[model samples]
Target: MHLAFVAFLVAGISDAVDGFLAKRFGWQTELGAYLDPIADKALLVSIYVALGYYEYLPAWLVIAVVTRDILIVGAIMLSGMINRPVQMHPLPVSKVNTAGQIILAALVLFDQSFGLNLVKLTTITVWVVGLLTVTSACAYLLTWFRHMSAYEADVHSSLKQQKDGSQIKPRHFGQNPRA
Candidate 1:
């Protein structure tokens, strides 16, 4: 259990390493798009579970983290429902929240070595970060809604204009054969 918790921390650190290397070498790829968040989620959720199981951290902390993930999952499902895909772009607040989580989790594990309670400091900070996490989730939702709304409006406007005898038909993709 202890080793697993530390493993999660190391994996979280890898996220930063990958980000730096990607930006430094222009090695960003579609796989990183999926891998980065997945790694973060695994690290976070594993720590949450370990802490809660051992009662090192309050159960509510884990609940809060899970709730944020639920929000993200809901957003993905909503995007799918609307037929508009969403790209995972971590907002600044989200990145901060993630960093806070990684720090708090690592601190919790370190506290075990010293047999001292670090939850007092980590708990307060976690609450602050949790609030930011929720805020970021709401921001993502708003952005997704606006994007899908604009797409629907554009489709409707094009259809309406076509119905009203507008001679400007929409062009097909990459087919500008000058007739």
Candidate 2:
């Protein structure tokens, strides 16, 4: 457990370091974009599973966390496979959700290490994490739905324009075609 806590701390620190380097040095790459999230998710999921197995956390919460990540990864894969890759920006609620999960995990590990008996804090954190997880999932789903709807509308509009012999084309500003 202690080793796990240490590893978690190291992972958190490394994430900050990598992010700083990416922004400061303009070292962002296509691979980093995908790898960073995958690494984070892998670490988080592993920690959650370990914690649950040891009875530090609830199994249902563990399932929820793992399920959410699976759903997200699955959606991203499906989108890419269909050649309609969606740009995923972390929503504010999702950021809060990540923070809540990190805090909860840290607190649980700390309590276990020192026998702090922080039941009240643990209870509050668990609820926050659970609620945020569900909300973040909903937010992502809603965004995906809206994006698909807009894309469909655009396709329909273009098809209609084509069939009506009114194909829209870009024109330069202050330029008239008949001039």
Candidate 3:
């Protein structure tokens, strides 16, 4: 059981390392896209369940963390249904949420030896961070819808322009240096 947690902790650290390597060396791969979050959830869920068993973290906190992941996954599915790509840009709130979860998890695994009221503080922080995570997830959904709507509108306008004898071509993003 202890070894499982150590492995999970190392995987959690790799989450940061993976992102750094990806951005630094342009080593982004589709496999990393799938594996990164899978590894994150694996580590988080493993630790959460283990800590819950030990009564270090509350069951409800575990639920919140898992539920947030589900909601974001649902958003990704919705975006896919719309034929729009859901890219993972690390939003600040999401980063904060991740950090909060890691802190909370570590506190739980550490058996709350510190006099910082780890359980109470982590529980409160979980709720606050959970709200931010949900909001950012919603923002991603809204951004996807807006992007699709704008694309459709541009297509419609382009068709109209063509019928009206305008010779304008629909411009690709960033194709023109002058905005």
Candidate 4:
């Protein structure tokens, strides 16, 4: 438990340092944009799963966290498959959700490592994490649905224009249709 706690702390510190360096040195890249979130998700998901496996965290909370991630990724993939790839921007609620999850995980790890009882605090944190997870998931789903609906409306409008013979035709350079 001590080793696990130390490792978690080191990982968190390293992530923070990496972000600081990237921003301070203008070392950001497109790949980093994608990789950063992936790394964070991987870390948090793994921690939650491990804790739940050891009975340190509730099984339902673990499921909720994992499910939320899966749903978000599935939605993105679905959008791409349908030829309307959605650019993902993290919602505000998601940030708070992640913070709560981290706090809960840390609290559990700290308590276990030091042989300290934090049942009450841990319980409250668990509830907070659960609520944030659900809320964040709903927020993301709502955004995705809205985006897809707008895309559908756009496609319908374009189709209607074509059907009505109201679509504009491109003119060739140095060539006239009337000539």
Candidate 5:
């Protein structure tokens, strides 16, 4: 348990430190953009699954977290398959959800390592994490749906214009045709 806590602390702190260093020195790269989230999710998901197995965290919460990640990945894959690739920009709610998950994981580990009975606090944080997880998933799904709809509409309009022998420009989501 102590080792687990230390490993978690190192992983959490190193992420922040690395981000600071990257920005401070302008070391950002495309590879980092892809790997950073993968690392974060890998750590969080693994920890959650481990804790859930030990009955330290609820299994359902772990399932929800994992499920949300799977859905996001599936959406990305589907978008690519249809030739409309997704460019994800993290939402504020998603950031909050990540924070909540990290905090809750730390709290749970700390409570176990030191034998601190933080049941009430743990319960509350867990629920908050769960709520944020679901809400953020919904937000991402809604955004993806809207983007797909807009893309389809633009394609249909362009095709119709071409068939009608008229020059018409189709606008994408958040784009102005007049501009």
Candidate 6:
């Protein structure tokens, strides 16, 4: 447990340092933008699952966290399949939720490692994490639905225009229409 706590601490610190360096040095890349969130999600999900499996955290909380992540990823993939790829961005609520999750996990690990009784704190954290998780999921879903709806509307409008013979035709460069 002590080793695990230390490892988690190191991971968190490293993530912070990586972000700082990226921003401070203007070294950000498109791939880094994608990988950073994926790495954070992977770490959080893995820790939550392990804690839940060992009965350290409530099963419901673990399920909620995992399910939200799965839904978001699934939605992104679905959007791509439908020719509307959603760009990944951390919504404000999602950032809060992630912070709460990280804190809760670290608190649990710290309490376990040091054999400290932090049940009250842990209980409060559990509720915060749960609430934030649900709120974030709803926000993301709502945004995705709106984006898809708008895309569909645009497609419908274009089709209608084409059917009415009012759509603009593309002209080739250096070609004379009189020819």
Better of 1 and 2 by TM-score: 2
Give the alpha carbon lDDT tens digit for every residue of 1-179 in model 4.
Answer: 99999999999999999999999999999899899989999999999999999999999999999999999999888887977667667888899999999889889999999979999999999999999999999988877777776666666777876776553332221122233
Using lDDT as the measure, name the better of candidate 2 and candidate 6.
6
Candidate 6 local lDDT, 67-171, one digit each (tens): 999988998888879676667677889989999999999999999999999999999999999999999999888777776766566567778767765533322
Q: Work out the TM-score per prediction.
A: 0.76, 0.85, 0.65, 0.88, 0.88, 0.87
lDDT of 2 at 30: 86
Evaluation by TM-score, superior candidate among 2 and 5? 5
Stretches of model 5 off by over 4 angstroms after superposition: 160-179
Overall local distance difference test of candidate 4: 0.86
Q: Write the per-residue lDDT of candidate 5 for residues 54-162, one digit (tens) a residue.
A: 9999999999999998988798778779776666567778899999999999999999999999999999999999999999899888777877777677678778767
Off by over 4 Å in 4: 158-179
Indicate whether candidate 2 or candidate 4 has the larger lDDT.
4
Mind giving the per-residue lDDT tens digits that candidate 2 earns over 1-179? 67877878898998999999998999999899888978887888898899999988999899989888887777766666865456656778888898899999999988888789999999888888999999988877666666555555655778866776653342211122222
TM-score of decoy 1: 0.76
lDDT agreement with native, every candidate: 0.69, 0.78, 0.64, 0.86, 0.85, 0.86
Measure candidate 1: CA RMSD. 7.4
How close to the true structure is residue 104 of candidate 5, measured as C-alpha lDDT? Answer: 95
Model 3 TM-score, all chains together: 0.65
Please report, as a residue range, the 10-residue window in candidate 5 with the lowest summed lDDT: 168-177
Model 6 root-mean-square deviation: 9.1
